[model samples]
Target chain A: MPVSAVEVLDARFDAEPDHWPELTARAGLRADWSWPVLAAQAWAARVPQLVTVLHGSEGPTGVVASGFVGPTTRRHRFVGPRRAGGLGGLDVRAPGTSAVPGWWFDTDDGHGGVHRLLAEFLPGIRRELGAGVCAALLRQVPEEALPLLEKRGRLVRKTEPLAHLRAVGDRDAWLATLPRKRRQHLRRLFDTIDDDPTTTVRTGGAVDPTRAAELLRVNLETHRDVPIIPLPQFTGQLTALLARPDVFTIAYTDPRDDTLLALGVLLDHPELPLARHWSALPEDEGGRPGLYFHFYGELMRWLHDTGRPRVSLGKKMVDLKRSMGAEFTDQYAAALPLVGLALLGLP
Target chain B: MKTGIGRDSLRGMVKTGVDALWRTAYRRVVRSAFATVPFYRERWALGGRTEPRLGSGSAEGAVSTEDLVRAAVDLAPLAGGPTGFDPVRGLGGLLPLARPTAGDGLLVALEHPGARPVWDLPRGWRGCLVDAEVDDPALPEVGAALGAGRPVVAVGPDKALDGFTDRVPGGDRVHRVPRRTLDRLDSGPYGVLHDPVLGYLGVLRDCGLWHLDWTRVYARRTRAGLAFTLLRQRSPRLVDALVGGGVPGRVEWCPRHATPVVRTVAG
Candidate 1:
């Protein structure tokens, strides 16, 4: 019997079952799936959070975090309201971070329990939320999961590409691989901050939550597409996140006034340390220019010192991130509509 | 399922023309639901409905929240969406967009947990969570923020704000705001504003009158008033849902805006 009459239970990250870690690892999920990171993200957003666990007769079959990406961020033209268009339909993406599907399943999912989970249960979620139009928006879904989702009637579209910088040998060895022009360009940007006595970049620095939140808000404003939460909520979330042992901060400060100018938050995974969040003041507003480019130098330096294999740089600035020797991966957003109108009454 | 388009073609179409691909896929899915899904099939057959149209509201009849809630599970079209993050759901993510000048500082007080006012703040301006339903541990921190000397904009219902106002200092700084005012601010000057049920569906402003979002709903003139047919919801399929208490309006054209306009008696 392949998971007939399965039940899906919603559990808070902290209250999840004891075997959750073993289950996650068995399903091949990364460090971002851990309780601390997910809980921190939920608390920071101040949004309601839950993780759906699929239960078959044997035991747990699958797990994924419920991350709501409203019309504000999903941005696909068809999914929004007609007038403001940005305000219609609810889209729930898995994990809500990184360029990977946060969903993981037990190998025993052989009986197409995923199809049942997708076809029947997901809509129950939409109704629970009191949403009329609900869709499952999976980000960075791998190739293997396509048929399972598509047969369930999801409209998958190509999203912006994601980048990863493999931290091999030392900084010198990595720089040697890049073209001469590209190497010189990077060196100049890195040296501008390195040589200047006024500027200082330190990895694993004690970051001021308030300052980091402000810098992040400013940086997010530059990219209007990203959702920027309120200041106090962001600060509170950052406070909890920075307290985690597996998380570290790279701070860029103006030594003269002791003002924190830029911040980068990284999640420590043995193989791939993720650069989760980065923010800086505007260049024209007494902020150092090329800080974004310069931070990668600091990241590489930390990677060499710590002996990590690579860094997941995340999406955007594809050309620039690629030029710095970061490999790119194609990403997609799959939309699976969960409700139909006949159920709402107008035939 | 016989439009000659395969699953692989749909996947391949993702890289090239996405809009066309989605429309095609939606047509196929909707067609399949009307034919295969038990709910859509029986309802449409009784109503003598034929092929369903997209963008326009459904071909079914209107239903009530009670009726829809009763048949919730029966609305699934035999497929899709999620779980995990569905345990708790909260409304209001639109923050206050009020940006205080460099000299004057603004302190936003969220008196209600559900109240989300969009705000674009400068360096000194900050937001404080001041929920009045329970004894929030952050009251002292809010007191500390108020001590910094900034004009406060308290957002919440009157009762909630009363509790907050009674407890917190700086009586003169706190300005209680109503839900309507927040709605107006959120919609902007030109954008229409209407409160949706559970922050999902409700009336929208059009030509200074209230109506359902046409793209998401289809309204038909009935003896009772206007019955709404949900255009694009997936789960429990709602055909014609009678919200009740609405006065029907005449469809008109506005030269100024150059879009179809309706003047309703309920504005």
Candidate 2:
């Protein structure tokens, strides 16, 4: 018998150590997907019933990424990843697909084997879901997977805009680019507080874990009036980041009164040149004077002064962020074909 | 020696006067009810037909304090009940005279002789009541004149009622009240009694108002000290955050005399 077979199993993180690595290899080998990072992210999300495993014959050939059923209301119906400008990507419409599945493989040799492996395994999982499965939404899908998914269901293309900011040279150089009026406003703001004998902006090392937790609590409370999906696992991830030295926390305070008006945590990814997991005090609290804005500004200045290349001012606040001279980046998702569909459509 | 004793006596008298003034300031409330108000008089007359002793149990055989007190207690059920505000014909007995439309979307107009017509309507999907106090008595009469149908009233402001009336049978009708009479009822010393009763009735008219959409309300109150009855509703995470003793996102404290203030996590 020919040794051509692909197996799909729903496995947990503890069940398979090499599962993530295998998936990444296959994604890179056949479709340029990043499955490894995605698996880590999914694990971090604590999404129960994570449908993932290694697939191949005899040995691992590719990784399969899947998640539980997630519902979207009429309000959040528009939420999904999409292609924008020239950036080709997939929008995870099914409400639970990962942005970066981090599937990587050595494609230097050939694509036939890996493509066959993915085509065979994708449908097997869909069949397993059977009538229960409606449609699969994916984002940042590579071009190769498009032909396969098109055979399975309708592909609605859309464009999603994402904004980003790049930290230029020292703080002054970054500030120099701002319109003179804005720069003057910033200067007056800094000077107004600087002159106040009681007010002080303190720059320091990693945020005290206790204080970081407090900032998170405040951030959540400030938004209590607004409706949003709760992220229960965020605290654990935040705590983990706090434990690392690379993570920096800054506080704006009235030193005389020993009152902390605002605080922020910036996760410095030196290799990636972006600040990850950045959140601050909500703006209604006098923004800069309120501590969150002040701390964010101080943190940006520190990064610039320390020769850090760039910072990722993670999502939202588009207009204000762009005014501060931050550039933008695009995120993507993709869909894969089910085995039966590919086999039926094979020419 | 006698003069010193007299001075001490005078001081004691001043102290007693001051105490009386303080007590009156804190505990005294001026309460008045419309005595000549046509609605009360007419309602009382109707009530007297069944109960001959209506409004006669107290001094001067007028609607006495005791009658007012009894009416207050009996009026509780009239708030948003199945049988509209049962027309109380006698002083203390309530009679189910007319059956108002009983639907979630139906609006009711409380017509008072010589007072602005009060329309108690449903407030969107939230189940609360939004009250529009139109000075025009014609408005309530228009609504009352409305047969069993949905009618849209074009509400405009003018000293003289200037809206054109087009009646569509089986359409919602706009109830109306006479202007001069509604003005008298809405004003005068008796308004004190009328306002609270109207507010209470309005509260009852909308069932959701009593509960106050507890989900969002309780979520808002989780951080505050407002008391609420916790029924077996879907447990929102906000309640969990409040009772579970986790770190609060923000702590808001409103002093009795000062403005409300919020302290964020960074503060």
Candidate 3:
């Protein structure tokens, strides 16, 4: 019985309703990430994009930030968002696209006309994209959205467990919410970090592209063997991420040499601040024992003290995340329009 | 009217005669086009269309920068539309066409990735100066250029750079394509097309072309005569089948384009 028009926008920060943070605050939204504005501009400077926003009768509704991604051998396919960068699962959908952290929108855990918005959203982007829809592979979509997609009768969905802490009351209350073992372990971490005169905790600062790049290199080198984003793109993208007023970095540094031991980036939205990316010298720069435990301790403490709701830790490393007393939910992925289609992950 | 007895003079006289003949044919066709179709009529009334200016020494049809730009503006409307304007269609069966003057930039459009390798360009019109679609068999080079974060842009597959940029010669760094690659892309794989308004829209240095999408290319008797359409296929061999005859023609540089999108994030 919803007959209102759904609007598609350019998804830029300066677009309608003017500013992003104010829009989120006004809507009493659940989770909306800030990377789209940052990454879209940075990426647009280098690639072709077909990003769009979904709007209903009330203010802003959903967002789909997509880009042309593929080898020129065939028509480039449009890819959706990813888990590591996005705050995860909004409501908008672009044509032939669904990625981790697929959309960002305002809905009571799936009460909005979100499904209907996607119904109207595809054709618009397809016309703008000037090509056929290959497939929309959305990973880690919210559990709330599953029933809606299931009712449509054409989609492939898989569920995976996602863990994170949704803080309540104070730091003590949050700690109490965790199991005794995790609470004690986390408390011991803070005490050790505090006891170290040589190690100091620094918070409320921006991530430097130079140091951020170095930190990212440390993480990627430890994880895989792929070449990182070249300095220009890396810096441009990092600079955009850093420019957000709500974004801040926390670092464990050696007061002796003034080098970052471990650094974590937190994106502050109305609902929660996500630990978007974090890296450090391996095992505390191959020397320190407490820095790894220290980064998260301070992160949780900061979120609690600042009266924030929670923090999305990240994908994978489940065993470790679980030990920290994080509540876990199953992340569902669905390939849309063309259901049952095997999805190829972004390279 | 002087049958000057010298061989040089005789060559000039033949050239003049051939020029007059081709020009007359060109005018007759275009005139019929404008008078018969509303699309061409409106296009002529507004400005230039690629007439392939005849009145040449070799009777070779060619275009100048002024003419190319003029024609581009003239045919802008037909660039994007599902049906050619007006229902009447023209196969434009075989006609003399002017060779496009090699401008500062050349555009290459084909289905084959690395299609640029098969293209032979005039010295001034090199692939390095082109702003083409993301297709090229020389993808390694394209990928390398992209990886290096060069000034490459991803445009629609249908777009090709016209004699458009003034980015001074020798001012920019370019990865030069060898002549050998263009050699592989040309040869027998060519098909000739003569559009009612744009003249010979297909690539080829000469005429005697075949399999032109005459019905779709010309809209009047064809569709509102307000638009024109030329089809593009993935295989060069398709051109032969579509042409249905063994006549030879070179590749036509298509100028119609959709907006180009640059890839900010690498896959």
Candidate 4:
């Protein structure tokens, strides 16, 4: 048993440790786990944000980032908004990201760590968030972690598939590792992108935060039900993240008029460089079709050249991501009601 | 009543205490605003400001009344705890009618009959929709509430507040509120000055100087006027907004007051 003290601190508290970067690197967690990124998310968040730090006798064991999800919070098209003050749940997930659990524990007993995280320390999180927070919504629990979580809470039946692309060696070696169909399709996309005369694919360019946010908003508006982050907050978060040396952008622009058509924001880590956010103009509105694939190809090339192992290609577009040689992880959500009474989204 | 301690020593102590409180509050508000409120997050991002500190010349623009009116709900911090201001109806939700606690006294919320009936009088309180715009029948009732021996706090537009006080018998107890939308941010921290939209900005101390509410609001002097960043309000989030026209006051270190003093400059 990892005998430890789980201390829940306000995610924005000044004295909280900047342990995110180190922990993220060790666990290959997504880019949204960083202190600056979480801080940016917390600053614009309407509800209270908390970070549960599980400290062992040796040092810190794990950290879980969360916030209270208000009743009116419509998280994408699938999740319906609850009645006012009805389901003010503690969301144990990163705000505004592809489905992924916002926790990581470095222990041999993974199940034990998770048990302690949910069963022992959860009530404290609820109290900090407020009494109205009557349930905890844990998103994107991996298949391996499902058994333990399923025993304690209600698991949403649908499974979200998380995508990942591995860069085993140089460009040629990486191509060989992929399936024949995906490899050939990727080559065709790359060739088209390379031969195009009207467009220019520029990697490692400065991203104008406002312009990028506008492009993202356009992309999000394509889906009728999804609510986009207000442009200013999105721009602000991009500004902070993009300023760092490790965070870079790949842009596909119209060289003739210098208009930005597509943009891919990537976070660089020694082990995995993540393609965090991607936005492009639709085909009818002056955007080229092969931009996303080309962006992925560029990411793969960078990983090979930099000797990085893999890239975190975020959620959705499951079939498309799979056709491009990405592996999938079955992700499920677990909702544990804080109060004894059953709540919406719970069993 | 003067002690042996010098004026400078007293001032130093006040400054130290105020600075410490200001720093803690500033960090909390700024960080929270960025995380949950899109207005501040976007504005600060466009301004190229990061890791903000007091007096850091980050060149933040002022928020206008028009902006607040348009994006009132969006202005509310998404994850800001459970209770406080309600996003749908600004100040009206502060005190729900269902729950009424005693010992705090009664609050008379005066509003123009035409305005959205956002004010729901809490238990032990009363709401009278007085047509302050013109001569209305509700004035007598307001006057009656003020005269009733119980402690009463009257809040409304300047004209309405003024009209009630001028006509009412116990007008001295009635508090005059500002006409501006941003200024009427919140109703009561009772005697202290506060903007529900901008958090508590300052308190008018007995020493005849405005003591900045460093814990709840962060203010900066701009060429236009004093720009305020609400340090603590979660709902109806407003940050880096310029107090319209300009606060006609000069901020100075007052040894006698033992804190930073805002001396009102009479135009």
Candidate 5:
């Protein structure tokens, strides 16, 4: 007789203390966005309806956490909240799996056991979500996991653009990739606004809570007349993330009046690149030229000078990102079944 | 036996016309302010003024345009306060002052049945003519004029007509001019503006309309719609703040061919 065992644990917000280290370690195993504590907090506030967990084998062979919001209806699709930075709904990350789920798996890490566990456990997870589940939308999966997810379900490919520079690569080689005119324009932009000591960039390990709240209030003020739902939610989520040690803040300051021209709150994922929350304020003392452009240049250069490898510009401002030399990469979203294949045929 | 006034009389007439136009515009501004802004509403209430009756006298004598302008200036501090950034707060303060010129244009065009002046139509792929005679003068006051009782037959820009129906309240009568029919009309005022902006203004001009009554138009922009909803829900106090906050004296009209033509018109 062979001994057999499987253990599944439902993780709550407070239980994070026991599971955090393991979750963080597993996050390190692969470039998983959802496993981060900040992602967990975002899900909690924005889409609190879905179940989030730490699923694994008896003594912890694997770990997966997921969330869902909105009623499970036949015609409805699982869409990520409007403000979600990456693919909209149902994100999964396990050891040896890339943030982009469709790529080829790297077999060097002996991920076969975890892969087997995920395959066996996913059906049960589907059953819990209900029968109308369509596809499991995964985004930013590394090149390795693509084939694995395809083997499990139907796959679709899309390109997601990202702006990155290597912490240790040759700067000249990186700059060579940009179009000549664009490269020259970027250089000019830097040169044109490089002067003015009044504009200084400051980077720090953590964000102050009071300052975070103030920043959020000001952001709302700027867009008070515009109507959108996700902004307020994003502000709340950023405020919470500011209190965490893993998050950091970079500010472009106007030394003359102590005004914050632009502030970016970034989350450090030592296993991958840095993710950022960005906001800016126009510098006008009685309707004159402001430091918005100058501050932005200073901040980007500061990040370059520091060892941070890349910056996720996130959503909106696609044209601006292209001007800055960001390349487009594939990002994907999928829906998962509660039971299995039979549900895929639902509308 | 003179169809119009003589030269010496014409100068007097011109001065009177100028003064009348100025006064009418100012009255419209004030009326809109009192109707939309809560601070003005409160001011009127405290001054023992009430609805169904003019501020203290007829529409002309009750509140002078100068008084309305001063009120707007006084209320400028209220913007961004309790009202957040609602445009109504700013516009309400200025409506009493600006409405005379703004409102007169509409009223004169609508009240005169035989005066059919062909203005430039909104440009671009979509364009239509505005027959001023059909408009209802009372529409602004009652907020019920978006319906077909207004006389403008729009030609070309079928989508714009469709958008009007969807966006305007009681917009069942706004009919689209078939492409064949538009080719027959003299292309009114080409090269006036560029792109969607030109196209938009062309529609307004061709329609023979200058100002928009936001109370009747719908806003398609989700953010704008939400802002309007929030403003409506929190009126008066929010209106007061907008007035007191010193919002600029600018009017924001809804985009033409937008789902709702007049999502917001702030003065």
Candidate 6:
């Protein structure tokens, strides 16, 4: 039988039952979207944070984090990574602008429990905050939360078309699903690595500090257009992530001189693998042409062999992700004033 | 007694509703865009606007698509319109634009006569037109919408219309309107700036934590919708996330016209 009542508790995330890893598993969270991962990212960014657990009559159903940015008097809610629409302190409280945080929920309630939690829990927070928040915003939430939000009358949505890969069978099976042109392109990339003994890819091992440092080095090189958290903060976050058994680094090396040509990071989750970050050396640094292509092919192969279902490259790189058989959606954020939404009695 | 209206049935109903919801709204917008803005005008509207295209790091109308499918999901209409264009107000109009879009549908602001300050659309939504006519005298009416009360979407020109003050003491604003012809067909300067039929929706307060705003979209315009959704079905990450979430619904994209279809999945 299902429990009729659920409770929301404002507590440290490390509380009883809904503990890290354990609750994450129970909630069926993905690495990038989960509270633990997001909190770590937010912490690295030095954002203010708080946690709330949605406990059903039986146990905890969902756990979400509220990251505060801007002045406390006019703070906004932030949910996921800063780049993925998570709020930073600066963008908060610009006149007429509200914020939506990145958030995740447990899989236990079929996400219905998440809605109940939002409906009951969010209002409770409004009163607690005192000055009162204008509205709650969520970005890049999947179908799970979308439908639940749709049930509300005033829903604002923007699809985020993300790049992902699904493994039906081993490498060959995966390639077969791609467009013939794309398949041919990828085949050549994979064949180039296979045929050239000089270049090799490595996976399935803990990343030592040295390798982690190299990953950061390459990251700075390629992600100029995108934002990177402060190095010390990122390094700290990377060390914690590397400590996890499920997270691993993928490194491509030039065999002749053993130079680190390109590096990518993958966070293994029960649902699918998450491509957290990656960077490659410039040509002079031994970054060979087609290294990105080769690494992705190799990564797909590994996912197939390991029975991992899919991989998320996060946001951006639309055309490239599309050619690799990826679909995209938009992410939207809305602000509904607490006093009005409740008083007006609208969804 | 057990009813036929089980969770699966409810899921089916919602999926059907969602399918109609996105496509219906999309078609209307696309139809409106194609009919209202002439090809020559799109160039003018496309120019002068400078917000890095809305999605995936591309500028709006920056990378043009030749594929028929990509044309259907074109977001240029939404992104480059006016800086002040708010989807919040437009969101309500979507249901009434097409048949079968569920919810308490919205009433077009024009439906009401008189130089009214705002139109009270369905579901407590307010619509405001920011144009030359707004006077200091109408500040209260404009302020009422901008004031901390209900969700309002105000549309206007590059500047806060000649007379209206854009400042709202307590509103979650998302933009600055720039000049552009969003609706050439309508003799008026209907560029997105002249409209706030879309405004900011507030943050969602929580039990212990507060969450800010969130919105969802199918595809940014000029991207191939059918191809993308088709690829989604084959995607393991998507399949797992969708199936794992246990929402009994599927988005069936029509490959030919590249349309949206909401399907109810069996539990």
Top candidate when judged by TM-score against the true structure = 4
lDDT of each: 0.53, 0.34, 0.41, 0.60, 0.36, 0.42
List, residue by residue over A138-228, the lDDT tens digit for candidate 6. 5444456555566444455564455676666767777888889989988887887778887778886555544454445555545456332
Q: Give the C-alpha miss distance for residue A75 in model 3, angstroms.
A: 15
User: What tens-digit string does per-residue lDDT give for candidate 5 at B9-82?
Assistant: 65565555644553354445444444434334334433334332332422212332233333332232222223
Ten consecutive residues with minimal summed lDDT in candidate 5 chain A?
A72-81
| Tens-digit per-residue lDDT, A1-347, candidate 3 | 23244343433222333645675456433222343433333222222333455556765565555443333311111122211121112222322112235455565435233363345444445444433444454555667666666644446466546666677655566677778888898788778779888787888865555566456656654554322221111333455567767777887777888777777777675554577667777763554675666676677778777877777775557787777656677666565552222232111
- Candidate 4 local lDDT, A232-340, one digit each (tens): 2355566667777777788999889888899988877776567877889888889888788788777777887787788878777889888777898777777776676
TM-score for each candidate, following the candidate numbering: 0.48, 0.40, 0.45, 0.55, 0.43, 0.46
Predicted candidate 5 versus true structure: per-residue lDDT over A98-174, tens digit per residue: 22222221123343323442454344445455444434544454344445555544554643444443333344444
Worst 10 residues of 6 chain A by lDDT: A91-100
Native-referenced DockQ of model 6: 0.01
Over 4 Å off, model 2:
A1-66, A70-134, A140-152, A157-159, A190-214, A217-234, A251-260, A282-299, A302-308, A331-340, A343-347, B1-267
Models ranked on lDDT:
4, 1, 6, 3, 5, 2
Per-residue lDDT tens digits for candidate 1, residues A218-276, read 66656656454221224434655677667788988999998878889887778767888
Taking every candidate in turn, the Cα RMSD to the unseen true structure, in Å, is: 22.7, 24.4, 20.5, 15.4, 20.2, 27.6
Misplaced by over 4 Å in model 4 are A2-4, A13-31, A70-88, A123-133, A168-186, A224-233, A340-347, B1-37, B41-267
Better of 1 and 6 by lDDT: 1
Which is the better candidate, 3 or 4, if ranked by TM-score? 4
Q: Residue-wise lDDT of candidate 4 within B34-135, one digit each (tens)?
A: 555665655553344444433434333556544554445346544433223322132333332112234444454455455444443445555555555566
Which lDDT value does model 2 have at B183? 12
Candidate 1 vs candidate 3, lDDT winner: 1
Per-residue lDDT for A300 in model 5? 53
What does candidate 3's lDDT look like per residue over B105-214, in tens digits? Answer: 32222222322231333344323323334333444454454455443321112123211112323213322211111112232223233322233333222322222233
Candidate 3 deviant stretches above 4 angstroms: A1-49, A55-59, A70-100, A104-114, A151-155, A168-184, A223-233, A284-287, A338-347, B1-267
The per-residue C-alpha lDDT of model 2 at residue B207 equals: 14
